[model samples]
Target: MVNVNCNILQAVDKNLMIADKIFRSRLMVGTGKYETVQIAKQSIHASGASIVTAAIRRLQINHPFEEKSLFKYLDWNSLWLLPNTAGCTTVEEAVRAASLGRELCKKIGQSNNNFIKLEIIPDYKYLLPDPIGTLKAAEYLINKQYTVLPYIYPDPVLAKQLEELGCSTVMPLGSPIGSGQGLKHLDSIRVIIENAKVPVIVDAGIGTASDAVQAMELGASAVLTNSAIANAQQPHIMASSIQLGVQSGRLAYLAGRMNELTQAQSSSPIIGISS
Candidate 1:
């Protein structure tokens, strides 16, 4: 058996609060896009994620005999089910989806069914979230006593608005959904992170471990990913690496990173060195 390091365990700060629920892991994984349920389970286990996102879609009644439901694979007791309005284009549709998600969670014995990841994506090509629709939906959900976590663009003004509107968290995309382009709007994301009072979660466009690390380093409370691990050659390994990367970045942020300098500074003593 391989020896485990106790120091590494002590270094990780595993407490994360989202919508009144405490999650041990900072990384949230998506349940879609995996090859199989077993593979998804393995990846989720390796990721050490306590929260998993699932899209709100109609169950196929035609194939009632076949086991096609995603819920069958999920362990509701351990993982917090975050149902998302991924394909909804309008505020009305998103609201309906959110309601359905809540009902579904209730059916699954999830008592704390107030959490929802609101996403209104009208643009199919870019898969960019509709800020106007998102804000409208968020307002509706918050009024309904739901803990809304709206997925939005990297706009400081919008993030502030969402926080003011009583959102549990504001999830801004680093880039387009599943683009793996990383933080294309770094300045705007930084602005959002700095200004928002609620937890800022960096969602989407994270390709690998480095992308997740960069997000955490930029002061993101958490990181959500899907395609980056699901599409990788080894999903389980990638998930584990991303988890470690997120932890390292969070530790670095807490430790206080050194300021950047334009010129290189000498490490050795110049007076003692022979010319």
Candidate 2:
């Protein structure tokens, strides 16, 4: 039997790229839904993710005077902050949020960090993003020199359009945000991944590490998971699990899977067998 070595195959995959920065770990965990700030920090550390995305509108990044500021607890030097426009429902709101995110990054000493996770979520029930609004917001933000990572539905056409608009990465939801439903739009996401020039990071509704693996195995550059880890019974453990899943899936993709057969076949050679 031939021994399979993954580290040797790592050369082909290299690192997860977004704009100019490269991440070793493809599991980008979200900084939300945790019980406490301490837990959130612990989970992030355990996940071993170089990039951590947070909701700019929900979290307090400016109020350093307050006891519960995100900047105070998390170490900026190690982790890259990806400010997300989660609460915005309109193009105008999302664009303004992206601007605020840029200024916040500058103020926090991440002067070159212009990464913004654009989300125009007008759908209150499912928290789905508005494709038209997202496109408009992304176009405006990209013009301002901000690296926009737009959260969109699993539409290959829209993903292509966003890629052409100079958005850094196209984030398509596996399901609804914070729902933990897990990759409901699997086929559509696969098409997006196949056609996308930029990184296709699966953003939401990942309930388990298995789901994360599914997304990665289908050739996603990375996955941004929050509820799957944060809402887990053990957030820190789940975070680590996600890290493993992302790595495993990426390695599997790089290894190149075998072709499928319609019927079962014998493992042993039949023609060469001695009668």
TM-score of every prediction relative to native: 0.92, 0.94
lDDT of 1 by residue, 142-212 (tens): 99999999999888999999999999999999998888888899999999989978889999999999999
Candidate 2 lDDT, 117-223, residue by residue in tens: 99998889988889989888888988999999999998999999999999999999999888888899989999999998899999899999999889989999999
User: Which pairs of residues clash in candidate 2, taking residues 3 or more apart in a chain or in different chains?
Assistant: none
lDDT of 2 at 3: 17
Q: Return the lDDT, model 2, position 97.
A: 78
Per-prediction count of colliding residue pairs?
0, 0
- List per-candidate RMSD values in Å: 2.6, 3.0
List the lowest-lDDT window of 10 residues for candidate 2. 1-10
Which residue runs of candidate 1 sit more than 4 Å off their true CA positions? 1-14, 58-66, 271-275
- Report the number of the highest-TM-score candidate: 2
